[model samples]
Target: MADGDKTIEISMDRARLDLDYCYDFIAASYWSAGRTRGEFDRSVEMSFPVGAYCEGRQVGFARVVSDQIAIAYVADVFVDPDYRRMGIAAKMIDALHSHPELKRVKRWLLATADMQPLYRLHGYADLDDMMMMRLDEDARNRDPLR
Candidate 1:
């Protein structure tokens, strides 16, 4: 669970997640600036979430939505400003891809406005023209707890 320095610990245990730390960091993030607490909590409840820590204090977080059979979508990968570039994010992603429940997944997907190079280490590539998405303009207005 420790990174190269062995000072960081990464955990997939849902109970170990620090909600207060995660919500505060993600709420102000450019990608999820307006995300509600309920939405964040629901996401954690439904997904295989991972947290990176140092000395028992959380420093990073990521999650993967998967079926435990095949296919996975990686999202919400955030490392604290003071903890970036320490291979924490990579370790979290590796934890997901190599986790016993998801190692067999054939396809993994994620979207990042920047930071492509960081993901490249995990075998993520540029999307092909065939890839597409449809949006729900008011999805945010929808209740996540519902």
Candidate 2:
């Protein structure tokens, strides 16, 4: 096999997740900063996770919150700082797209501030004329754990 082909592997196995690495990365991210461990654990538990591994160590991660039908929301995608520029993120997205359960999803959604270019390459388009709305619930303010 070519060195490029052997460089990384992507898997949908939740057992292979490195929670500490994942949580730490998400906690430091712009979107999920200040996220608690319990929150991370719960989120991961509720989603179908994908991990990209290099030499048996997880180097990237992503998850899909799907109803296994019409919609699937891609969330918490990240490639370790050390692993950026390695095409790992694109591969991870490809794996998610090719996932058996997600294959039939009519719509896939994700929110990204700076990775629009990357996502655009995968057929995600800007919601230029459409209104994207959300209910802003402050979970930290409502959760007793805070």
Candidate 3:
């Protein structure tokens, strides 16, 4: 599909991913500050990656970590600053939701600091009744190899 004079394509093909752009964007994000390129690459390798391209240049991205049946975690969703406000992010999310492999997922989860409104528009609601917990970073830091 074309957005204005730019042709936009959202695809599931990992080969189309621009790793440098993705890693740079994610590493600068508030949630993933200090994330290494190796870590980002590993995560992309393990997930269902979606790339949004405008005029053959990657302008947006998202990844879904899923078991292909029960649940999926959407992560690292972003649109290049120059491409914002043009509905690219929403289109990427729509592509993910329509993916056949994720059609049977019973649950979808994502954590966003300030994008609740956007997610809510996509049918995600705050899990107000559920307790969300995380292992302390100290526990992770204590691991010898980590």
Best by TM-score: 3
* CA lDDT scores, all candidates in order: 0.79, 0.79, 0.79
| TM-score quality measure for candidate 2 | 0.82
Candidate 2 per-residue C-alpha lDDT over 65-141 given as tens digits, one digit per residue, 9 for 90 to 100: 98856677889999988778888889888888778766566677788878877887887876643212122133223
Residue 86 CA error for candidate 1 (Å)? 0.9
- What candidate 1 gets wrong by more than 4 Å, as runs, is 1-6, 128-146
lDDT of 1 by residue, 17-105 (tens): 99999999999987897799999999989999999989879999999997754467888989998888788998998888767666556
Q: Which regions in candidate 3 have their CA more than 4 angstroms from the true location?
A: 128-146
**TM-score of every candidate relative to the true structure:** 0.82, 0.82, 0.83
Q: Regarding TM-score, does 2 or 3 come out ahead?
A: 3
Residue-level lDDT of model 3, residues 1-146, one tens digit each, is 66678778889999889999899889889988878889999999999899999877899999989885656788999999988888888888888877866666657888877777777787777775321111122322232321
Score candidate 3 by lDDT. Answer: 0.79
Per-candidate RMSD, Å: 9.2, 9.9, 9.9
